[model samples]
Target: MSINLEGFVRRKTKLKLGGKEWIFNELSLADFARLRAKMAKERKVNLAERRKQLIEEAKGIGDIDPLKLLEHLDKPVTDEEMDAEMESIEGVGYMAYLSLKYAYPEVTEEDALKMLSIDKIEVVVGAMMGGLSGDKKKPKAKAKPV
Candidate 1:
Protein backbone atom coordinates (compact mmCIF):
# COMPACT_ATOMS: atom_id res chain seq x y z
CA MET A 1 0.00 0.00 0.00
CA SER A 2 1.00 3.63 -0.35
CA ILE A 3 0.67 6.42 2.15
CA ASN A 4 0.84 10.12 1.27
CA LEU A 5 2.38 12.04 4.17
CA GLU A 6 0.96 15.34 3.02
CA GLY A 7 -1.91 16.56 5.19
CA PHE A 8 -1.66 13.51 7.41
CA VAL A 9 -2.52 15.61 10.40
CA ARG A 10 -4.81 18.59 10.89
CA ARG A 11 -2.85 21.84 11.13
CA LYS A 12 -3.46 23.91 14.25
CA THR A 13 -2.35 27.51 14.63
CA LYS A 14 -2.98 30.44 16.91
CA LEU A 15 -4.76 33.42 15.40
CA LYS A 16 -5.47 36.67 17.15
CA LEU A 17 -8.98 37.97 16.53
CA GLY A 18 -11.25 40.45 18.29
CA GLY A 19 -8.29 41.19 20.56
CA LYS A 20 -8.17 37.57 21.69
CA GLU A 21 -6.12 34.53 20.75
CA TRP A 22 -7.85 31.65 19.03
CA ILE A 23 -6.61 28.28 17.82
CA PHE A 24 -7.60 27.74 14.24
CA ASN A 25 -7.52 24.30 12.76
CA GLU A 26 -7.08 23.66 9.08
CA LEU A 27 -10.44 22.78 7.55
CA SER A 28 -10.52 19.05 7.08
CA LEU A 29 -12.38 17.52 4.16
CA ALA A 30 -15.29 16.75 6.43
CA ASP A 31 -15.32 20.26 7.79
CA PHE A 32 -15.28 21.77 4.31
CA ALA A 33 -18.11 19.46 3.26
CA ARG A 34 -20.12 20.44 6.33
CA LEU A 35 -19.55 24.14 5.69
CA ARG A 36 -20.66 23.82 2.08
CA ALA A 37 -23.70 21.76 3.02
CA LYS A 38 -24.84 24.27 5.64
CA MET A 39 -24.41 27.20 3.26
CA ALA A 40 -26.34 25.38 0.55
CA LYS A 41 -29.14 24.56 2.97
CA GLU A 42 -29.45 28.05 4.41
CA ARG A 43 -29.06 29.89 1.10
CA LYS A 44 -32.33 28.26 0.01
CA VAL A 45 -31.39 27.96 -3.64
CA ASN A 46 -33.87 26.02 -5.80
CA LEU A 47 -31.28 23.52 -7.00
CA ALA A 48 -33.78 20.82 -7.75
CA GLU A 49 -35.74 22.80 -10.31
CA ARG A 50 -32.55 24.04 -11.91
CA ARG A 51 -31.32 20.48 -12.09
CA LYS A 52 -34.54 19.50 -13.87
CA GLN A 53 -34.03 22.23 -16.42
CA LEU A 54 -30.51 21.06 -17.15
CA ILE A 55 -31.60 17.47 -17.58
CA GLU A 56 -34.24 18.59 -20.10
CA GLU A 57 -31.68 20.52 -22.11
CA ALA A 58 -29.33 17.56 -22.06
CA LYS A 59 -31.83 15.15 -23.55
CA GLY A 60 -30.36 12.21 -25.48
CA ILE A 61 -26.82 12.80 -24.25
CA GLY A 62 -26.09 9.07 -24.46
CA ASP A 63 -26.57 6.38 -21.80
CA ILE A 64 -26.02 8.44 -18.65
CA ASP A 65 -27.84 8.70 -15.36
CA PRO A 66 -29.80 11.91 -15.85
CA LEU A 67 -30.91 11.93 -12.26
CA LYS A 68 -27.30 11.90 -11.11
CA LEU A 69 -26.56 15.01 -13.14
CA LEU A 70 -28.87 16.90 -10.85
CA GLU A 71 -26.22 16.60 -8.17
CA HIS A 72 -23.84 18.77 -10.18
CA LEU A 73 -26.23 21.49 -11.32
CA ASP A 74 -26.30 24.85 -9.59
CA LYS A 75 -26.92 28.44 -10.63
CA PRO A 76 -23.91 30.12 -12.17
CA VAL A 77 -22.68 31.98 -9.15
CA THR A 78 -21.36 35.55 -9.35
CA ASP A 79 -18.57 37.09 -7.28
CA GLU A 80 -21.11 39.45 -5.73
CA GLU A 81 -23.33 36.49 -4.89
CA MET A 82 -20.39 34.68 -3.34
CA ASP A 83 -19.42 37.76 -1.34
CA ALA A 84 -22.98 38.04 -0.07
CA GLU A 85 -22.99 34.37 0.83
CA MET A 86 -19.74 34.75 2.77
CA GLU A 87 -21.29 37.42 4.98
CA SER A 88 -24.54 35.67 5.69
CA ILE A 89 -25.26 33.69 8.85
CA GLU A 90 -24.55 30.44 7.04
CA GLY A 91 -21.56 31.82 5.25
CA VAL A 92 -18.28 32.93 6.80
CA GLY A 93 -20.14 33.20 10.08
CA TYR A 94 -20.68 29.46 10.06
CA MET A 95 -17.07 28.91 8.99
CA ALA A 96 -15.83 31.06 11.85
CA TYR A 97 -18.02 29.08 14.17
CA LEU A 98 -16.70 25.79 12.90
CA SER A 99 -13.09 26.97 13.12
CA LEU A 100 -13.57 28.33 16.61
CA LYS A 101 -15.40 25.31 17.97
CA TYR A 102 -12.49 23.11 17.01
CA ALA A 103 -10.38 25.03 19.49
CA TYR A 104 -12.84 25.73 22.31
CA PRO A 105 -15.11 22.72 22.24
CA GLU A 106 -17.64 24.36 24.51
CA VAL A 107 -18.25 27.30 22.20
CA THR A 108 -21.69 27.18 20.63
CA GLU A 109 -22.41 28.36 17.11
CA GLU A 110 -24.50 31.10 18.68
CA ASP A 111 -21.49 32.20 20.67
CA ALA A 112 -19.37 32.27 17.54
CA LEU A 113 -21.95 34.41 15.77
CA LYS A 114 -21.98 36.80 18.70
CA MET A 115 -18.19 37.03 18.62
CA LEU A 116 -18.09 38.45 15.10
CA SER A 117 -19.67 41.82 14.41
CA ILE A 118 -19.73 43.60 11.07
CA ASP A 119 -16.65 45.57 12.01
CA LYS A 120 -14.59 42.65 13.27
CA ILE A 121 -15.57 40.01 10.75
CA GLU A 122 -13.18 41.24 8.09
CA VAL A 123 -10.18 41.22 10.40
CA VAL A 124 -10.93 37.83 11.87
CA VAL A 125 -11.62 36.24 8.51
CA GLY A 126 -8.53 37.85 7.01
CA ALA A 127 -6.38 36.51 9.82
CA MET A 128 -8.06 33.15 9.51
CA MET A 129 -7.01 33.13 5.86
CA GLY A 130 -3.36 33.58 6.91
CA GLY A 131 -2.31 36.94 8.42
CA LEU A 132 -0.73 36.92 11.90
CA SER A 133 -2.61 39.91 13.33
CA GLY A 134 0.35 42.22 14.07
CA ASP A 135 3.58 43.31 12.51
CA LYS A 136 6.90 41.90 13.74
CA LYS A 137 9.15 44.22 15.73
CA LYS A 138 12.83 44.35 14.80
CA PRO A 139 15.31 43.14 17.41
CA LYS A 140 17.96 45.52 18.74
CA ALA A 141 21.67 44.68 18.47
CA LYS A 142 23.47 43.55 21.65
CA ALA A 143 26.57 45.36 23.04
CA LYS A 144 29.92 43.58 22.31
CA PRO A 145 31.27 42.90 25.85
CA VAL A 146 29.72 45.43 28.22
Candidate 2:
Protein backbone atom coordinates (compact mmCIF):
# COMPACT_ATOMS: atom_id res chain seq x y z
CA MET A 1 0.00 0.00 0.00
CA SER A 2 1.23 3.46 -0.88
CA ILE A 3 1.77 5.71 2.10
CA ASN A 4 -0.18 8.94 2.35
CA LEU A 5 1.56 11.71 4.24
CA GLU A 6 -0.30 14.88 3.36
CA GLY A 7 -2.43 15.88 6.33
CA PHE A 8 0.14 17.92 8.25
CA VAL A 9 -0.66 21.59 8.44
CA ARG A 10 0.59 24.40 10.63
CA ARG A 11 -1.90 25.88 13.06
CA LYS A 12 -2.15 29.26 14.72
CA THR A 13 -3.76 30.28 17.98
CA LYS A 14 -4.62 33.49 19.76
CA LEU A 15 -2.71 34.23 22.93
CA LYS A 16 -3.71 36.92 25.37
CA LEU A 17 -1.18 38.44 27.69
CA GLY A 18 -2.05 41.11 30.17
CA GLY A 19 -4.55 43.21 28.18
CA LYS A 20 -3.14 42.58 24.71
CA GLU A 21 -3.52 39.65 22.36
CA TRP A 22 -1.35 38.20 19.62
CA ILE A 23 -1.44 35.37 17.11
CA PHE A 24 0.98 32.55 17.81
CA ASN A 25 1.78 30.09 15.08
CA GLU A 26 2.60 26.45 15.63
CA LEU A 27 6.23 25.53 15.33
CA SER A 28 7.14 24.71 11.76
CA LEU A 29 9.76 22.10 10.86
CA ALA A 30 12.19 24.93 10.22
CA ASP A 31 11.40 26.43 13.60
CA PHE A 32 12.04 23.11 15.29
CA ALA A 33 15.40 22.85 13.58
CA ARG A 34 16.27 26.31 14.77
CA LEU A 35 15.19 25.51 18.32
CA ARG A 36 17.28 22.36 18.29
CA ALA A 37 20.30 24.33 17.18
CA LYS A 38 19.73 26.94 19.84
CA MET A 39 19.37 24.33 22.55
CA ALA A 40 22.57 22.65 21.42
CA LYS A 41 24.39 25.94 21.64
CA GLU A 42 22.99 26.70 25.11
CA ARG A 43 23.51 23.24 26.58
CA LYS A 44 25.50 23.09 29.80
CA VAL A 45 27.05 20.33 31.85
CA ASN A 46 24.26 20.45 34.41
CA LEU A 47 21.43 22.50 35.88
CA ALA A 48 23.88 24.24 38.17
CA GLU A 49 26.13 25.14 35.26
CA ARG A 50 23.16 26.42 33.27
CA ARG A 51 22.05 28.54 36.20
CA LYS A 52 25.53 29.98 36.60
CA GLN A 53 25.62 30.81 32.90
CA LEU A 54 22.23 32.48 33.06
CA ILE A 55 23.32 34.57 36.05
CA GLU A 56 26.39 35.72 34.20
CA GLU A 57 24.30 36.46 31.16
CA ALA A 58 21.96 38.54 33.29
CA LYS A 59 24.85 40.71 34.41
CA GLY A 60 25.68 41.47 30.79
CA ILE A 61 22.01 42.09 30.12
CA GLY A 62 21.97 44.70 32.89
CA ASP A 63 24.94 46.56 31.52
CA ILE A 64 23.22 47.48 28.29
CA ASP A 65 21.91 51.05 28.09
CA PRO A 66 18.68 49.89 26.47
CA LEU A 67 16.74 46.70 26.94
CA LYS A 68 17.89 45.45 23.56
CA LEU A 69 17.37 41.82 24.47
CA LEU A 70 13.67 42.48 25.04
CA GLU A 71 13.48 44.31 21.75
CA HIS A 72 15.20 41.39 20.07
CA LEU A 73 12.50 39.19 21.53
CA ASP A 74 9.88 41.62 20.15
CA LYS A 75 9.01 42.94 23.60
CA PRO A 76 8.13 46.60 24.08
CA VAL A 77 9.99 47.35 27.29
CA THR A 78 12.56 50.09 26.95
CA ASP A 79 15.58 50.69 29.15
CA GLU A 80 14.14 53.89 30.58
CA GLU A 81 10.77 52.29 31.23
CA MET A 82 12.21 49.09 32.63
CA ASP A 83 14.50 51.09 34.88
CA ALA A 84 11.49 52.62 36.58
CA GLU A 85 10.07 49.19 37.43
CA MET A 86 13.36 47.29 37.64
CA GLU A 87 11.53 44.09 36.95
CA SER A 88 13.13 41.08 35.30
CA ILE A 89 10.98 39.96 32.39
CA GLU A 90 13.26 37.26 31.04
CA GLY A 91 10.64 34.55 31.43
CA VAL A 92 8.25 36.42 29.18
CA GLY A 93 10.99 36.99 26.66
CA TYR A 94 11.79 33.27 26.63
CA MET A 95 8.15 32.34 26.05
CA ALA A 96 7.91 34.72 23.15
CA TYR A 97 11.21 33.61 21.77
CA LEU A 98 10.11 29.99 21.79
CA SER A 99 6.53 30.46 20.63
CA LEU A 100 6.64 33.39 18.25
CA LYS A 101 10.32 33.37 17.28
CA TYR A 102 11.19 35.75 14.42
CA ALA A 103 7.56 36.69 13.84
CA TYR A 104 7.11 38.04 17.36
CA PRO A 105 6.03 41.64 17.40
CA GLU A 106 6.49 44.27 20.04
CA VAL A 107 4.59 43.49 23.24
CA THR A 108 4.89 44.88 26.72
CA GLU A 109 6.60 42.67 29.29
CA GLU A 110 3.61 43.03 31.62
CA ASP A 111 1.27 41.95 28.88
CA ALA A 112 3.49 39.07 27.84
CA LEU A 113 3.72 37.82 31.42
CA LYS A 114 -0.03 37.96 31.71
CA MET A 115 -0.32 35.72 28.66
CA LEU A 116 2.07 33.10 30.01
CA SER A 117 0.52 29.98 31.55
CA ILE A 118 2.14 27.10 33.40
CA ASP A 119 1.10 24.71 30.64
CA LYS A 120 2.37 26.81 27.73
CA ILE A 121 5.58 24.87 27.33
CA GLU A 122 3.67 21.61 27.28
CA VAL A 123 1.20 22.98 24.76
CA VAL A 124 3.95 24.16 22.46
CA VAL A 125 5.71 20.83 22.66
CA GLY A 126 2.47 19.05 21.93
CA ALA A 127 1.84 21.25 18.94
CA MET A 128 5.33 20.68 17.60
CA MET A 129 5.08 16.91 17.96
CA GLY A 130 1.55 16.88 16.65
CA GLY A 131 2.72 18.64 13.56
CA LEU A 132 5.44 16.08 13.10
CA SER A 133 3.10 13.14 13.60
CA GLY A 134 0.13 14.28 11.44
CA ASP A 135 -2.59 13.62 13.99
CA LYS A 136 -5.56 14.24 11.68
CA LYS A 137 -7.78 11.26 10.89
CA LYS A 138 -7.14 9.45 7.63
CA PRO A 139 -9.86 8.61 5.17
CA LYS A 140 -11.45 5.16 5.29
CA ALA A 141 -10.75 2.85 2.37
CA LYS A 142 -13.58 1.65 0.11
CA ALA A 143 -14.31 -2.07 -0.27
CA LYS A 144 -13.93 -3.66 -3.70
CA PRO A 145 -17.06 -5.15 -5.31
CA VAL A 146 -17.52 -8.86 -4.53
Q: In terms of TM-score, how similar is model 1 to the real structure?
A: 0.49
- lDDT by residue for model 1 over 1-146, one digit each (tens)? 97787766555656555688777665555665676666566445677677667687668676667767765554444556656776676576777777777678998778778777776665566545544442234589988996
Instruction: Give all candidates' CA lDDT scores.
Output: 0.65, 0.48
lDDT of 2 by residue, 1-146 (tens): 97785885457555554456656566556654554444334432244464555566767778653334333433334445433331234433444455554346565545445566655544433443444332345789999999
- Give the winner by lDDT: 1
Question: Which parts of model 2 are misplaced by more than 4 Å?
Answer: 1-10, 44-96, 106-115, 119-146
Clashing pairs in 2: 17-115
Global CA lDDT computed for model 2: 0.48
